[model samples]
Target: MSENRRAEVDAALADVDFEKFNYQVVFETTKGTIKMDLYPDVAPGHCKNIIGLTKIGFYDGIIFHRVIPDFVVQVGCPQGSGTGGPGYTIDAEFNNLPHETGILSMARTNDPNSAGSQFFICLGRVPHLDNQYTVFGKTSDAESEAVVLSIGDVETNHSDRPLEDVKITGSEVIVTEK
Candidate 1:
């Protein structure tokens, strides 16, 4: 890591207050349940947007349209294609969070502000995505990590779409007691 990048990561880690700004995202998928711990202090806008969307059942029935072995599994587009959103766009909350295994980040086009409801989970370490995507959360436990791996390991086609559809049966924001 470059000095500047390491500094930014250190700062982000220091800024995160687990006692207050922490949140839990529970994604009940057709395969299994995947849960993550969200860090609002690092990417507040993106975190808030996802939590807001989850409250209204926005992700229910949404399919993981893109899945790549050893890369990422993506979802959150209402259209089930990669081009859908919540009829609005949120500003990019780029941070120093690394795209390591189990990390969840916003999926955007080349344009930073284009990130809407689409997001992805990293199956392995992807340093190239560091500071480029808004990483808001990560798998919080062994069970969630296992589920993420299972989803990422599924078979996919040439376009990285899974042969069988993996749907998000439900999504919820879990408030943990501090």
Candidate 2:
């Protein structure tokens, strides 16, 4: 990471009010359940958009189309081809959060504000993505991290698609008590 990028991340983290923000979600996938803590302060629109999608079962039946072992496990594309979304786009909410292990981030094209329903879970620290993508949430604990790793470890083909379908069975939004 560049010095400038680190500085920007530091500024963003300094303003976090951990006690007041408690948006969270639990995703039940074929591999296991993973819980993530959403950051509305850093990415309000993206957080709300994910919550809205969850409430309407938008992620159900979605497969982990792009799973790279020790890197990331991406899903949330209704088309299951890494080219679909919720028929809408949200502005990028890049924050101080680095793309570390268990981080939940929005996936987009070259356009910064092109993210929609597609997202990915970081399996390890990835510094190259800092300030380039919107990180709206992350695994809240060791248990959730383990689940994400398990999903990332699935056997993948040349294109990084899981050999066996790893689908999101269900998802729900929960207000965490700060």
Candidate 3:
């Protein structure tokens, strides 16, 4: 991401009133649209990072680089591989959120604070991730949840890359009165 774009994202995030407004990110993917509700109260920084990135068109055309059956469907890697990010990182905000199906969490390296733009939506209960990853959001409705689960069921090679490309065609941030 460009420095100017990052600055614009920061400026926009600063104006948000989390207490009075609800934030959502609607992702248009090759499979279907998945709308996720952000939990700013539990993981404010993670929520802001995703919302900011979306507003800057950072997720457009990104592919779901990693998918594991009964696990997670990961995306937001600009390189269309699991090794890329938004050129910067955010500190972790681990909370008590359970890593159940439809839950959204940040993907990071061993360092908890290394999360950047990569994230995953759970396809089943992942108890090992509870309070380990930064859980910031979840599928907002049943339809969205179904889409995420379906994405997770896609066939992958040895590296977990989808046999067929599953790209995020576009993304949008939705803010509504709380």
- lDDT string, candidate 3, 3-78, tens digits: 3355767876886789899999999999999999999999989899999999889999999999999999999888
Instruction: Enumerate residue pairs that collide in model 3.
Output: none
Q: What is every candidate's alpha-carbon RMSD to the true fold?
A: 9.0, 8.9, 1.6
For residues 1-178, could you state the per-residue lDDT of candidate 1 as single tens digits? 1111222323334433455655787989998999888887788777777777776677899999999888899998777778777766778988887899999999998998888788999999999999888999999898898988999989989988889999999988786656
Tens digits of per-residue lDDT for model 2, 1-178: 1111223323334433446757678899887888899888788878877777776677888899999887789998887899887766778888888999999999999999988788999999999999999998999899899988998888889999999999999888776567
The residue-level lDDT of candidate 3 at 70 comes to 94
Q: What is the total number of backbone clashes in candidate 3?
A: 0
What TM-score would candidate 2 get against the native?
0.86
The all-Cα superposition gives candidate 1 an RMSD in Å to the true structure of 9.0
Output candidate 3 Cα RMSD. Answer: 1.6
Clashes of each: 0, 0, 0
What's the TM-score of every candidate structure? Answer: 0.87, 0.86, 0.95
TM-score of the candidate numbered 3?
A: 0.95
After superposing candidate 3, which stretches have Cα over 4 Å from the reference?
1-5
Question: Which one wins on TM-score?
Answer: 3
How high is the CA lDDT of each candidate model?
A: 0.82, 0.82, 0.91
Better of 2 and 3 by TM-score: 3
